[model samples]
Target: MKTNFLFTMLTGLLLFTACSEKPATTYTINGTIPDNSLDGKMIYIYNRDNNNLNIDSTVVTGTTFTFTGKMDTAAYCRIDASREYYVNFILENGTINLDLSKPVSPSGSPLNDEIARFFAAQDSMSDLIDSKRQEFMKQTEDKEERMKLQKDFFQNEWKPAYLAMLDGFFDRNLNNPIGGMALNYMDGYLSTDQIKAKLSLLSEPVRNTPSMQERLQRFDALEKTAEGKPFTDFTIETEDGNKVSLSDYVGKGKYTLVDFWASWCGPCRAETPVLAEVYNQYKNKGLEVLGVAVWDSPENTKKAIEELKITWPQILNAGEKPTKLYGINGIPHIILFGPDGTIIARDLRGDGLKAKVKEVIETK
Candidate 1:
């Protein structure tokens, strides 16, 4: 009996030691905004991976606040102080301090330190791009000269340098879950090979994440729908209880443009006049413009069409499925399909849109 009791005490001590050695799952955040103007204002914490916002909100009291919670992984989170002010850092199982002054950043965690370096490099590249763009815009008054500014700026300056910077950090933090955040910066800019290379930089487990899978799928869809390929066919139920198919408009012996837009999309609305001009100039010259409203409500779709005087044949309530099929992750995604239903150009914005339309219209 004494031997059994001694064994039980030893087992208890072993169990206690095991528990103590295990890593802590919960995280604590103590913040100081240092801006009294934000005193009593609400700060929202957003999970960058799955859902942005709707997680938690806390009130700032005298430039200080605290947040404590746990996450499944070393997920990245951004603190929203205002629309114009925010700071992003990894939410790991440790105390973190956020600085809200000019050049906002976070500290007190290893992931936060990595993110600081990453953000600094990104901000510098972005600032240089912005400065050059502003300088070019201010210097040029010629519409034709100004038209080439964006294309030139991105290809010549931003893409190479920005991607090189990413290559460095992604190489350094390949094992860290924060490395997954690099995917957010790459949209339509990176090619399949480049994207896959970056994805390979992430740890194996992270490569299997749902978000990563969706991104890969989107990239695949984009590749299949690339310019010079055959246009993808789609059909949607219109607001008036009629079925509208892409075949009915596109590939029926006319150059057809499908403007994938939503009512709530500001960029889409801004391009309304542009679309109107092109439709007017080219409709009589074998051009057809169709509006497919996705990621919007029926009421809003009708409201925008009426307000903007959108006379083009519109497919209302198109929703997300069509976008998923075409790999359109964002709004204002415009595609120009040839008479034989081959894609001529895609994602054409501003001057590129006008040029493409005019070029095709003049060709035939």
Candidate 2:
């Protein structure tokens, strides 16, 4: 009996030792590349959440490379062998296997597996849509009719399905990096209120991340500049080294068309002629057009103005100041301000721009 008791005690001690020696929570990436030329090359993993800084690196030994790190929380990162070859994945506590040979494949981790499933679903839907588009193109000979049908299919059918899938993804990852990533992608698809609802569902720690905080601030700015809200004033220095306030042009007893654009933006350039036409038609009849060059260098702005024949008074070198104030995410964002500086309409472009200006100026 004593011998049996001694054996049981020994077994318990062994079990305790085994449990105590277990490794702590950490992540490891086991990666492989098939190209023989890159056997001795360097592999880098960048933390995209933190200014895309290199968080870890390794030398490719033979055709394989490995990286291991302890993460307090999950982060979005990318593994790059070169600019041409990179795969973005969530770095979490688990072993992740990546094959960067023919196509990038990330597996063997929970979040990575989820990402694979998400992408597969997206691709399948995209393929289905493309097939429908091709079939419709064959049947519909009229160019305008084909384009209209395609637009309806994409908007009414495919987009809702895509958004629903994304909603499921976000719902599954409300407290993780994946949720934050999902929110970032939903900006163009979802309305501001919808995004706000999704963001509110996240935990405090996830919502307070730098990227998420920036999204929150942008939403606030959007609210401040919604249609009918008074225009927010800001100042920027022009290419001529003169300081100018948006107030200098806006709220000066005339309807002002404020264009927040960049020199490198194609759509902005295309819309310039439309703006010039409107200005010429109505400048003598209570209209003023102001060009605020944003997200471009002074040299490029001046060159674009000369090439595009933009004779309107321009505020150059504005950078991100005006965009942030107005929550303008894309270039060619044009706002029509009332004579007293109240925002009349926004997001004007093409014929719609001309129509809005004409309606207001002619009636005045």
Candidate 3:
């Protein structure tokens, strides 16, 4: 009778353990699009926190589509039918119901619900401003008048409301995937210092994301060479196999205009004539224009110089060395350095370049 009791106790313990075991975590995404235009479109899911990697895709049949998968951790993901129509949501281990017809309407997950509301508020602001712009465009045939109306609306209404929404969203969601996504959006609108300030407010889990790490590195590079900071010098090998350093021209005596460009870049080529014009106007005074050819071969650089009539001194075959040092992601990044090598202005383009050179030189 005692042996039977022991057996019964062991069986009871096994049953309890089996009941307490946790189930495998997974996610289900049930999406519907009422837009007939997107009935046969292919929908894609990208892991935004993971360098925008395309992790899953499916074709829409009729009015609905579904995606199911498991992830060890929740990530910020985006669903796109096309570039113009996309929605961002937290991909957690739960069922998510999404309506792709609207800007943001994901539901059924805690984080996704919050993200949806946040983006909905943002869409309202965008829609209102768009409506105002459309009305003004209809009223005015003059380009300048239309531009003025849009600019005034942006400064008075749109920017302040947008910033407030962004601030509130970041504050409320700093510890979640929503905060990570917000930081990515802030990249274009905020300065490096501003982004760093926001970064400090984020929780460790959010800050540790891949996109955040890349932003941190970019901010570091930008800060090291920001305006009013002294120039960071780099050496380049010329076409004649001679070495030239940026220190050779900058910080000597005259104000220097540095152009970081590539031979294959259309905008870079387009801006060369403007640079030449600026050089002619200011070289006799206290200005020097130096061209640093990046991400191009010596042959192409030389051919471009001859074809474009670029008379300025050039450092060829610089590759990506200079671009990395200055945090330059795109070519044709122009910088104006003070007489003492401090960066006076950056990203100068078109008539603004000429005006800035004029202002500084005339002041000198």
Q: Would you estimate the TM-scores of all the predictions?
A: 0.75, 0.87, 0.70
Q: Model 2 over residues 1-364: C-alpha lDDT tens digits? A: 1323323433321221112344449888898776666788888887777777788888888878889988887777787786555687878778988877523357777777766665555565677678878988898999999989888877777676666666667777887777777677778898999999989999887887777887889899999999999999999975567789999999999999999998899999999999999999999999999999999998999899999999899898898989998888898999999999999999999999999999998887
Q: What ranking of all candidate models by TM-score puts the best one first?
A: 2, 1, 3
**What is candidate 1's CA lDDT for residue 228?**
90
Query: For residues 2-73, what per-residue lDDT tens digits would candidate 1 score against the true structure?
Result: 323323433321221112344657878888765677888888787666556446678888878888887667
The lDDT per prediction is 0.77, 0.81, 0.81
Alpha-carbon lDDT of model 2: 0.81
| TM-score, predicted candidate 2 vs. hidden true structure | 0.87
Give the Cα error of residue 137 in candidate 3, in Å: 3.1
Best by TM-score: 2
**Residue 343 error, candidate 1, Å:** 2.7
lDDT of 2 at 261: 91
Q: What are the per-model C-alpha RMSD values against the true structure? A: 13.0, 11.7, 14.2
Task: Report how far residue 10 has shifted in candidate 2, in Å.
Answer: 54
